[model samples]
Structure formats: structure tokens, C-alpha cells
Target: MSHPTAPPPYEDHNPLYPGPPRPGGYGQPSVLPGGYPAYPTYPQPGYGHPAGYPQPVPPVHPMPMNYGHDYSEEERAGSDSFGEWDNRKVRHTFIQKVYCIISVQLLITVAIIAIFTFVEPVSEYVRNNVAVYYVSYAVFLATYLILACCQGPRRRFPWNIILLTVFTLALGFMTGTISSMYETKAVIIAMIITAVVAIAVTIFCFQTKVDFTSCTGLFCVLGIVLMVTGIVTSIVLLFRYIYWLHMVYAALGAICFTLFLAYDTQVVLGNRKHTISPEDYITGALQIYTDIVYIFTFVLQLVGNRD
Candidate 1:
């Protein structure tokens, strides 16, 4: 058995770590009775420090600011507006082509009329061959109606152009023959009035919000009635002439064709629910031209009767 050695005296300090005496051994608070690792220590008022020490402050960091942002809503709105603008541009282009075609048809008709009216030989020849003229006019009218119904806007370009041109020339020649019967002064006055009426109606149709396309069914019924009325009036005028009845017929015809013009113009503009296809520019022009032709014919009749 080994006996325990006696501790050194208080005056004999440790040679390896020589220091002043501490209130606590090792100058730290111990967690266990025998010193191992020490527990965390804090400053105490009655200990080496009279007052507690201040705690260290943590550094503050600012929140990140996002300078650039996504503008998805604005971009979407701009895209929608651009799409609407493109639609309007396309609609306007279709309308322009229709009008251009109608203008060409009108010019051709006017040129034929001028030639027949001003040139004496053509007018005399047509007047002398009245029977042959009627037969030819009937054939032309039949051919025009057949081609319009059959071909329409379905055929390819050059064929469509050729058929429409032939039909227009035939119709114009007939119109020229009719105009040759009227006095030059009467024809001029009627043409001026027809042009003024056409301009006014076109402007009105363009600006008005009223939907004429919806009234197509009603117009068709009215057309049949007008045709019957015209036939009766023609038979009456042939057997027994009534000046007032002729005037009424002319006035009614003019009104009908004017409404037709407004309706066709709306269809061409594509502002209606039931609209002509954008590709059917030729059909649109043909409808408008027919309306104008009827209007002119009625106006001429009214003026010719007055004379």
C-alpha cells in the first residue's frame, strides 16, 4: 500500500505557473467538484467587476431593393393594341380594293355611255336595229346572271377578271343604248344628281352605326315586291300611260337602290355580324355597282319623263 504525500506549504508557489491567489481556483467557475471543462462565466457586481458589462451589438444589413422589374402587363396590353390595329388595317385594305374595283366598273360604264351618246353612228345603228338589240340585250342579261351565280368569287384571278369584264361591258352597252334615247341635257342633269346622291349615301353609311346587313332578309322580300310592282307598272304604261304612276315607280326604285347601296357598303366595310369574306372583294364591288346602276336608271327615267 502506498501512503499519500503531504501538500506543499502556502509560501511555496507553483514554479510552472506562478500567479496571485484567485477567489476561485483556476480563476473560473467549475461545473463539477473536480475541475475539468469550466461552465460559461458572466461578470458579477460583487466580483472583479462592480457593474455588469454591456452586450456586443449585431451589425444591421439593409433589405435588397429591386430596381428593375418585369413589365409583363404593359407588354401584353401593347401586343393586344397592336393586334387590333392590324385588324383595322386589314379591314381597310379589303374595303379599298372593293372601292377600286367599283370605280373601274363605273369608269367603264361611263366611257361606254359617253361614246354612245356623243358619237352619232353608234346611237343610230342601235336605234335602227331595235329587234336585234333586244335579243342581244336578253342574251347579255342571261349570260351575266348565269356567270354571277356560277362563278362568283370562287374562281381564280384571270378567269374572274375576264368574266366580270365581259359582264360589265355588256351591261354598259345596254345602259348606253338606253341613255341614247334621252336628251343630252336630261342625261347630264340625271348623272350629276345620281353622283351627288351616291356621295351622300356613301358618307352616311360609313358614319352611321345602324346595322344594314341585318336587314338583308327584309330587303329580299321587298325586292320581290318591287319586281312585281315594276312589271305591273310597265304593262300599264305600255297600254295606257299614267304620268303620275311612272313618277311614283321611278321614285320607289330610286329609294330601293339607295338602301341597297348602303347595305352593300356596310358589308364591304366588315362592320356587320354577317359580312362578306375579305377575299370576296370582286363580289362586293359587283353588288355596289349593280345598286348604282339601278339608281342611275331610275333617276334617268324620272328625268326623261319630266322632259
Candidate 2:
């Protein structure tokens, strides 16, 4: 090889590209490294060039803003959201249909209970107090409240649903047959009240969309208070103390209970953390069902007393 070339003379030094920060006024024109393919340089139209050149315009549209990292990524996210929405809609729809079927089932159960009471040629007193029928109702309501609202005693929802169904069916059947102090007209009035409360509470749930999860603890405390108050009032009434005050307490209790039902139902329907199973649907139906039935029965008793 030839001897190594000496450092270039002062005027001959050709530094390769002068490194990045150019010395002249051309401070690297904010371009991407290769200048975006040079944007097609235009030639001057003098010297017999196409002077009247009708230059076709470059297309001005930008490449789409990539919301996704890849095509499959966008597609996957879109399909997931759509699928979740669709699944929820279908679940609610099927639940509603199932609710209707269960309602019919309850009515059939009531008819059976009623037939047993009347066709059995049983005494009226025996038919009336027949082995703590109302206690089953209390258990059903408590079961629903627990299942619909709480996360503690998990997986009991399905058993609770079956129990409530059996209880209501039994109640309906018995109530249909036996003679009672309250008339059907009174019951009808109660039904209307219950229905109104349900609708109002549901509308409130939808319109507000407020998170009331904190109120859950307060509700439990209040339920205990109501139970204790009812027991005390029952004892007092047994001693021949006519306390209309207890009725007022009960009326307010009913109102609170109605709101609770609505809020709880909304949570099951929309609360993301509360994954509603098929049993939850049954539980929800049971909640509304009891709310309606009791409010109806209560109002019926009060109305029928107008003699």
C-alpha cells in the first residue's frame, strides 16, 4: 500500500458532511432525515420547458392518525367493546323474559296454596295461621336483600332464588283460597302504590347515575333498627297499647325499602364489579316482586278498613 496520506492542507480539508450542525444559514430544515422523498423537485419552466405547464396538484390528504398500534389491535378493541355491549343487552333481554315466566310460576304456586286451604274442608282458623306462612316471606325478603346487595356470602344467590320462588308460589296459592280480613280491592290498591314506588325509584337510579355504594352500610343499620322497632311495637300492641305511631314508622320503612330495591337492582344491572349471574337475575326479580306484593298487601289492608 502507498504511504498514509498526510493531513490535508488548510484549504483542502474536505470534512465529510461537516457533521450535523451545519455552519451556513441552512440549519437542517426540520425535515425527516431523508426529506420525505424530496417532495418531487420542480424544474424552472424557461428554455423551451413546458412553459404553460398545468401542474397536477399533489394529493393533500394525510395518512390516517393511527389510534391503534396495529390494524389487528384496532379491530380487536372495537370488536371487544361491541361484543360486551351486545352480551349485556342479550343477558338483560333474556332475564326479562325469564322474569315473566317466573311470575307466572309464582301465580301457579299461589293457586295451589289457595286450593289446599279452601278445598281441604279445613277450619278457617287452621287455614289462617297455617304454620307461619308469613315467616317464609320475611326470609325471602331478607334473602333477596342479602343476595342483591352484599358480596359477602357469595354463591348463595341460586339457592335464595329457588327458595323465594317456592315461598311466593306457596303464598299465592294459600292467599287465593283462605278468607282474610283484607279484601282483594285493598290488595289492588297496594299493588298500585308498590308499582309507583318501583317506577319512581328506577327512574331516579337511571337519571342520577350517582354512586351510592357508601349508603350500603347505613342501609344495613337501618334494617336492623326496623326489625327491632317492629318487634317492640308488636310486644306493646299485645299489651293493648294502641300505638298509631308504629304505623307511621312502618310507612316510612316501606318507602326506604322501595328505594333500596331500586338502587340494588340498578347496581346488578350496571355495576361492573358486580358480575350478575343467572341467579342474580332471579334475585333481582324476587326483590321487585316482594316490594310490589307487600306494598300492595299493606295498602289493601288500610283501604279495606274504610268499611
* Winner by TM-score: 1
Task: List candidate 2 segments past 4 Å from native.
Answer: 1-86, 94-98, 105-164, 171-179, 241-243, 272-275, 301-307
lDDT by residue (103-169, candidate 1, tens digit) is 9999999998898788889878877777745764786676567655765433567777876787788
**CA lDDT of every candidate:** 0.74, 0.53
Clashes of 2: 9
Per-residue lDDT tens digits of candidate 2, residues 149-177? 66543246466546556656545544443
RMSD of 2: 13.4
Q: Which prediction has the highest lDDT against the true structure?
A: 1
Q: Which stretches of candidate 1 lie over 4 Å from their true place?
A: 1-86, 132-136, 151-154, 305-307
lDDT of 1: 0.74
Q: Model 1 compared with the native: what TM-score?
A: 0.68
Question: Which clashing pairs does model 2 show?
Answer: 110-172, 110-173, 113-173, 113-174, 114-173, 114-174, 186-300, 190-296, 191-296
